[model samples]
Target: MNIAIGCDDAAVEFKNILKDYLVSLGYEYTDYSEAPKHSSNLYADVAERVARAVASNKHERGLIVCGTGIGVSIMANKVPGIRAALCHDVFSAVRARKSNGAQIITMGSRVIGPELAKTVLKSWLDADQIDESSLPKVQRIMELEDAIQLG
Candidate 1:
């Protein structure tokens, strides 16, 4: 699956490490950051770009990184039709996709090490199918999002 990846200056190193990991895992990804080591754009801006790409179906999923991951997760979820989850562990990563049907996962560069991040990413990527029991819950989330956007 094609993945949209981006990060702010605070997580450039983490982003690069994950990018290489993505390649090693045989996944194609598009980097939305401005530069290799430094991104002038704010975390929210990068998150929105990646989230929109996934929401529009241009990419299958998105991975965003920030200093705390919270900023990007909140920003990405602001977009309509996007469920962005801030995940710090493999279980959360898997549940983000399996339970919430999240199309985007956000990670904190400063909070997680590279190996743990890779493990989380791998688990999330492997969780391709959403649980049937969670379908109604996911639908409710989308409905709430639509209602909020419409209002």
Candidate 2:
């Protein structure tokens, strides 16, 4: 699957690592954050770009990274129809896709090591099918987004 990936200055290393991992796994990815390694671009901006790419179906999924992951996750989720999950562990990564049908996964560079991050990313990527029982809940989430947008 094609993946949209981005990161702020704080997570450039993590992004590079993940990009190599994606290649090793035979997945294609587009880098949304092309700024210099230590550029001042805001994490929210990168997150929005990646989130929009996925929301528009330009990419199948998105991966965003920030200092704490929280900032990017919050910003990405602000976009309509986007479910961005901040996942630091394997279980959360899997559930983000299977239970919430999240199209975007955010990682914290400061909180997770490279090996653990790879494991989390792999788990998320492998969780391609959403559980049938969670369909209604996922639908409810989309409905809520619509409700808020129409308000």
Candidate 3:
């Protein structure tokens, strides 16, 4: 899947680390960022852009980061069709994808180290949808399919 990623100053290092992880896993991606960290950085702007990109289907998945992860997650979800989840553990990450079909995974720079972040991303990718009734968040995908006559 093609992923869109973004971060503010607080998570630049973490973003780059995760970007490398995505590359190693052979995922296509694009990034929106605040600064290079050698210079000034901003979180809000990057978050909005990343959210919009995903909302527009520029990428099917997104990863965003901020100091606490909450800021980016909250901002991304403000966009319709963008289910951005702030995940600190592997379970939440996986459940977010399976239940919500979340397009964005937001992480806190200070909350999770690179190794744990990698694990969570893998879990998110590997998880399967539980069942039709268990996936209210992704019910839209089913609704779309149900619209087809298949006749």
Residue-wise C-alpha lDDT for candidate 2, range 60-120, written one tens digit per residue:
8999998999999999999898999999999999999999999999999999999999999
Is 1 or 3 the stronger prediction by lDDT? Answer: 1
Off by over 4 Å in 2: 35-40
> Per-residue CA lDDT of candidate 3, range 1-151, in tens?
8789998878888999999999999997898885545644467667778889888988878889888999888888766666889998998998898777788889999999989999998788677455566676477655654565342
Residue 82 accuracy (lDDT) in model 2: 95
RMSD of 2: 2.4
Let me know the TM-score candidate 1 reaches against the reference structure: 0.95
> Model 1: how far is 79 from its true place, Å?
0.7
Evaluated against the true structure, the overall lDDT of model 1 is: 0.94
Greater TM-score among 1 and 3 belongs to 1
Off by over 4 Å in 1: 35-40
Candidate 3 local accuracy as lDDT?
0.82
